[model samples]
Target: MSSALVRNPGDGTNFRYYTNVIEQVVSNAETGGLATVTRSIARPDQAPPLHTHSREDESWIILSGRVRFWVGSTSLDECDVHEAEPGAFVYGPRSVPHTYQAITSTAELLIICNPGAIEGYFHEAGAADTRSDASHSLMEEYGFVIHGNPPPAPQTY
Candidate 1:
């Protein structure tokens, strides 16, 4: 990825990734700046472990369906839940803990990571290739923090 790349609507490095999420790394780390594009298709009840990136800022451009995001705030009790819809944009600053779930039957998200430091985690975790309800331990190995086992109970606002 020494040079920038253009991916047609249906092209990129696609991976089954982890449970409930499908990922595609559009721009790799070698592209410079570690700026990367990752597309995700998430199904209902598909939520990621709560974690924070140590060196990258992330943004999600909602393409379809609905996503319930827990951002910045540590606990669901902090009342930071947000429901994002198509055409919505959500930003996660570096070092901030964030997590989300697809509330609808399915959701599509375009995530951009600048100065992406965990691209390798995507490769390895995506390789583990397991789709389950358990947490992903790899996130911690990639310099991200997994808050705890089992996320806090869902809070309805």
Candidate 2:
């Protein structure tokens, strides 16, 4: 059997991503301070709260299905959300409040983070009060600002 099948890179206690967001670090980030991997089984209608990081930048590549990404005040609906499917890629810079919502029933996305440890910001984003002012405060502390409007209605595939 492949060692990959028996090894666990992220366990609940050690990693924090949207429980709904399934991810695995195919390669160790410790070696070079970055992470690269293919993540699959992402469900539709799920989204991370609006937030950003001060220390890392994330690049997302789609393997299957579609993802709607929001940048700053412009939502995917307002500013041409990049529709990525196998071979499509989107890059988000550090300190920009953004969030993604799945459009297809099951979407697979590959996420690469430079300085890998920055995922802690993602963990924190998921923890913030997306509906309250507290969320905004946290976002600001990390150099992010939430958009005034919420995400747009889901787009049918």
Candidate 3:
């Protein structure tokens, strides 16, 4: 990133993951020891599955629109669901199962992965996005597990 004064405002790689578009802003390679930042552009109903990471903590900063989320250890049977508006912030520590969905027509989330690990998964998860659930191999590779699948779409999403 130091090579340029700044990344062009509209110059981020957009990866279609699940039913949403994740525009990578700051890659793990760029952050050194900092977190990787991604801009999640989502439509209503788009969401990730209940999953957990064994290493890095996840941070979500709602930039616009509304998002509904569940985060905790009790699993889906018992978990805290929350409604987040613009400027809201949510944190998921390592080992916690969490999931979230966009509740508005347009929801933008600034996602930060501390210790900068999951960024590579976003780039390399080519055909794994088809099913909401991450395969065991994929989970092992990314250090995350899908407690339950989110929904099924084309694997190549």
Candidate 4:
């Protein structure tokens, strides 16, 4: 049995395990449940679209940099924004429509979700924009669908 939460990617294209440090980390996974902790570094122009999930609730804690998020009808801007430097925490319930954009070049955030939803979407589905129909067709079993937002631009590390 695997005791450590980290999963080594070895030489694969995926990110490294616990030692390399990832903003978005999947700490737990079971037959019907999982917990994901993400540490994300977002470029100033990077942002997700306005969308909602019917499956799981999310909680975010800003580790560094600045990020503005949309919750319901309210938008948190730079001026009146919530600064999550190191210890700040924010929770987002399911079915709430929201979007987020990075106001700074480097923004790190930790997103935690119960009964893991997005992780499966990212790992199993191959992300909506990155894969061809043949690759994504397998994900239909989990309630995955492409709705809002286009695929992210390809960048080299």
Candidate 5:
């Protein structure tokens, strides 16, 4: 049986992954492997490479600033792009290739993953001492397949 859990603002495990700040608010262990939640702050250059998850479905709720997300079931070259602002929600199902980039100076978003396994990846990869030498193995262990760089950000005239 699991007891109730509460996390106030700034009350979570925080770490820096690349240029993004990630806070794991709810762990899979606490929920008995049902779900995991995290809060992240990122800049435009902090966007992740194009990738697909083999295990969990991921969702995001935009909290502040603007972000552009590319989601597709088949390939990155053919995907739906969405520009979201505060209060926007996006979902990326398992096996779907997806990535997002902040369009404003800064963006804050809440990330949720079903079945909670991906939290392990975040915890390990976000460690300050983690080395790039093990990145491929770590990603494989976490059920992630890196495709390539995300599409270039849309140009503003």
Candidate 6:
């Protein structure tokens, strides 16, 4: 049995991953592994490496600024780039290589993952004492396959 959970703004577990601020709004433990939601404020330099999730599907709701995403069916080299503005929503299915870069000065996004385990990776990788090498291993341990670096940001931004 589950009860209702309410989290006020800025009332969740917060951490910094690289140059981005990530807040775990709803964790897997609270939802019995159904899903997890995280809010992130990212800058252009905070773009993630091209990667694919083996265990979960991910969706993002743009809250502010703009973001450019590269999504591919199989390989990182073959991807379609899309620029999304605030109020846009993007979905990346499991095993699809994808990565995003903030195109504006700053971008705020709400990320949701199904089957809810990615938050553990976020928590571990964002830990104050975590090292770069350990962060790489944590991605693998958390079922993420790294393909390569993110694509260059669009000049139109």
Q: After superposition, how far is residue 104 of candidate 1 from its true place, in Å?
A: 0.8
What would the per-residue lDDT of candidate 5 be over residues 58-116, giving only the tens digit for each residue? 99999998888888844567778889989999998999999998888888998899989
lDDT of 4 at 77: 29
How many backbone collisions does model 6 have? Answer: 0
* Candidate 6 lDDT: 0.83
What is the TM-score of each predicted model, taking all chains together? Answer: 0.79, 0.62, 0.81, 0.62, 0.87, 0.87
Error of 5 at 84 (Å): 1.2
Query: What is candidate 6's lDDT per residue for 20-62, written digit by digit as tens?
Result: 6678889898889999988988778768889899999999999
Ten contiguous residues with the weakest lDDT in model 3: 148-157
Give per-residue CA lDDT, model 1, range 1-157, as digits (tens).
6455667656775665655345565655456656778888866545667778887888999999888888775665563778899999999998888888777777788988877666667756653356332374666666777763334434332
Better of 4 and 6 by TM-score: 6
List, residue by residue over 15-82, the lDDT tens digit for candidate 3: 76655567888788887856798887766445677889988999999988888777885366576878
Residue 115's lDDT in candidate 5: 86
RMSD of 4: 6.9
Q: Give the Cα lDDT of each candidate.
A: 0.71, 0.58, 0.75, 0.54, 0.82, 0.83
Model 5 weakest lDDT span, ten residues long: 126-135
* Model 5 residue 42 CA deviation in Å: 1.5
- In angstroms, the error of model 4 at 4 is 9.0
Models sorted by TM-score, best on top:
5, 6, 3, 1, 2, 4
Compared with the true structure, the alpha-carbon lDDT of candidate 5 equals: 0.82
lDDT by residue (tens digit), candidate 2, 1-157: 1333333434312332545444555443433545534364556545655556666687888878877777754354444355667678888887666677678877777777665654545556552234233545745554545544545547657
Candidate order (lDDT): 6, 5, 3, 1, 2, 4
Off by over 4 Å in 2: 1-16, 27-29, 36-40, 74-80, 121-153
